[model samples]
Target: MNALYNCISKYYPITSEAWKALSNALTQIKIPRNSFLVKEGTVCNNLYFLERGCLRGYYSLDGKEITYWFGFEDNFVTSFYSFISRKPAVENIQALEDSTLWSISYEALHLLFDAHHDLERLVRIINEQYYIRLEERFMAMQFKTAKERYEQLIENSPHILHRISLGQTASYLGISQETLSRIRSQV
Candidate 1:
């Protein structure tokens, strides 16, 4: 739970009292590699904050997984659409590695937010951060070529190419695996 406290502390210091109040509300979740945290068509019930692990969010189309983003330790993971709207998700959130996370259901989070002003602000700030990240990805996809995107990916997270499968990496870059291979060879 140190990670939880530290992560929250970055945005705002959590008092001992606040921590005590939240501790019992958080549930520990163990996610296995290659399985889902949130599946398509299911409403996301929990807001997961990864303590130790990596995860990817993807959409499936024509029987293929098209990953758009990845998240690592000390990061929050969820399907925003499903979470905010209480509707079924169109994306899938899956662990890339075996991970342990701390999670609270939306209902529990709302209750806490209502009770704690700081927590409400923290969630809003975190939401804004996610929105900025999404905007960056969208702009990259809109303006960059496949090779350029692959280059940017390599520049950003060189290990990502090594850690995930070729298909998965290609999908995340919005390119075919063959194109990914070509870009990779040049690098």
Candidate 2:
């Protein structure tokens, strides 16, 4: 949990009391590769901190899985829309590797926010960061060519190719596996 503490400290320092409360709320769980952390049509009840390994968020469309985002170690993982709106999620979150994560239920998190202003502020900042990344991705998809997108992905997150299957990577880029292979060879 040192990793979680370190990450929280980077965002905002909490009182010992708040830390105690948060620690009590966190439950550690391990998910094997290809396991679903969250499935479509379910309400996401917990927010997870990826302590080790990777996860991907995707949606099923026209019988294809379109990956939208990835969560790596030290990142928070959740279906934001479902978690916030109390609605069923349209996206599925799956473990890309054998993973360990610290999870806190929505109720527990809201209780903490009510009790600790610092914790609330920290979460607000984290959400803001998430929104910024989402906007960046939206803009890229709207404006960039597939080649340009692939190049940007290589420049920004080259390690992703090593961590996930090419097919998944291609899906995330909104391209076919064959097209990704062609772009990769040209690059």
Candidate 3:
């Protein structure tokens, strides 16, 4: 939980009371590789913070899986639309490696938000940051070349290369593994 503490503290300080409340709400669990955190068409009822390993968010298109984002250690991962709207998820999140995660149920989170202004602020900030990232990714997908997208992802998330499979990485880049190999060779 040190990772969670450090990450949240880096963003904003919380009172000891707030910290205790959050920790009390967090449940630690281990997820094995190849497991789904949230599957398409299911409602996402929990928000998880990865304490170790990697998770990928993807959705199937015409039976092909296309990855949209990855969550690394100390970062949050969730099917946002499903979690926020209480609707079925359009995306799926899976563990890329065996992982330790801290999770809070939707009810628990709302309770915290209602009880603590600091917690509410934290949630707001997290939401804003996630939205910004989503917009950036959407823009890149619409405007950037495949090679450019690959380069930008490598620049921003160098460690991801070592954490995920080549096929998964290619999927995230929206390219064929062969194309990723060609791009990698050129680099």
Candidate 4:
């Protein structure tokens, strides 16, 4: 896929054999809207790279879905804890639209990492980036006011409001649907 090739090319110019090997390890999967890639309590077997459409990672609390992050085209989506430790995932990854993605199994990823040091470095970089995003989100939730968070959310992801429902967006911002509506009224 072009997305996969682009990500690989960002790290290095892969040899023809390397490209072939990488391609061999990946598979294209189409997910219907509201379908799940990783469900709660299941080990996440693959790292998904979104090619088209959108997805969200959320956890249920008090019968509520609280979204922590969204993934769209060109983003890598996965439950790292379940994928890395081979344990049950605490979160769910769901498609918000008809989605296309390229996925590689954890075992296949490690095999490729072992086979190529550069790929290992690339993986490390991606891991660090993901961690930083999580840290930033944690900080934002702790330090920013709900209205401020709402503003930052739009600034960071201007297209998200158009893509998902307000209730979900409210959940992502850790606010109730009514509160989100009030905030929207001001904007």
Candidate 5:
């Protein structure tokens, strides 16, 4: 769990006492590739920290999976809407590779917040970062063409291509695999 501690320390430092509380709340688990972490129509009860491997968040739309985002090592993975609102999620989070994760239930997190205000602030900051990325993605989708998006993805996260299938990458870019192939060939 040193990796988790290092990641958390980069965001906010917690006292040993607070760390102990958090450690007690976290449950480490392994998810096989293609396993569902958060399924559609289910309430996401836990927030997970990806200790190793990758995951994707997607929606099943008219028989097609529309991937929205991906999470890699060190990423916090969850259905944010469902986790925060306590509502059923419209999207699913699936492991793209065999993954190891540490998770904390919503109830446990809130209890930690009550006992340790620093932990709350740390999560708030992390949520703000997530919101910023969400806004960036929204703006990119609004203004960029598919090719531009593909190019940006290549420039920003080229490692993703190596980790996930091309079809999944195409879905994340809001394009067909054929279209992605064409763009990729031209590049």
Candidate 6:
């Protein structure tokens, strides 16, 4: 909970009263490893703030899985489009490790927006940050070589190299595991 408060505080000032309201609104949940936070074809109505552990978002294509994103502690994990659009999710957000998360329902968040002006501002800022991250990822996928992408991934989240499986890391980098091994050897 303190982690969540600190994360929010980094972006927006919160009044004590608002903080209390938010604390009361967020529900803590434990997710076992290999559990799905958001499954494909399910509407995602909650946004999760990870307090501990790791998760990955991926989708299957022609029976092959493609990893889209990986997130660890202090990260916000969600199917943002599905949550915002109220549509079925295209990807699955799965816990890679036993995890603890603070979750707020979409309805609860909107209610908070009306009650806390600062929270509303905070959400807007968060959206902008999410967009920028998405854009960077897009550029990396479109313009960067697989090795470059792997390097960028290391720079962005070095812990992922140790925490995730080689196959999963290769999928994330859009390369074969053998290629990943080759690239790793070169490094």
lDDT of 6 by residue, 84-176 (tens): 999999999999999999999999999999999988888889889988999998999999998899888888788888999999999988899
Listed per candidate, the RMSD to the true structure in angstroms reads: 1.2, 0.9, 1.0, 1.4, 0.9, 0.9
lDDT by residue for model 4 over 1-187, one digit each (tens)? Answer: 9877897677557577667777899999999999999999999999988999999999988898899899999888899999989999999999999999999999998899888766777778788888999999999999999999999988988899999899899999999999999999998
Candidate 3 Cα deviation (angstroms), residue 25:
0.9
In model 2, residue pairs whose N, Cα or C atoms come closer than 3 Å (at least 3 residues apart or on different chains), thus clashing, are: none
Model 6 misplaced stretches (Cα beyond 4 Å) = none
lDDT for position 166 in model 3 = 88
Q: Which stretches of candidate 5 lie over 4 Å from their true place?
A: none
State the weakest 10-residue window (summed lDDT) of model 3: 8-17
Ranking by lDDT: 2, 5, 6, 3, 4, 1
Lowest lDDT 10-residue stretch of candidate 6: 68-77
Q: After superposition, how far is residue 50 of candidate 6 from its true place, in Å?
A: 0.3
Quote the positional error of residue 26 for candidate 2 in Å. Answer: 0.4
Q: Is candidate 3 or candidate 5 better by lDDT?
A: 5
**Model 1 stretches astray by more than 4 angstroms:** none
Q: What do the candidate models score in CA lDDT, each in turn?
A: 0.88, 0.94, 0.92, 0.90, 0.94, 0.92
Could you tell me every candidate's TM-score relative to the true structure? Answer: 0.95, 0.97, 0.97, 0.95, 0.97, 0.97
Candidate 5 residue 5 C-alpha distance from true site, Å = 0.8
TM-score for candidate 4, residues paired by index? 0.95
* Model 5 lDDT tens row, 1-187: 8999999999889889999999999999999999999999999999999999999999999998999999999998899999999999999999988999999999999999999999999899899999999999998889999989989998999999899899999988888999999999988
Q: Per-residue lDDT for 82 in model 3?
A: 98
Please give the range of 10 consecutive residues that has the lowest summed lDDT in model 5.
Answer: 168-177
Q: Candidate 4: worst 10 consecutive residues by lDDT? A: 8-17
> Which regions of candidate 2 fall more than 4 Å away from where they truly are?
none
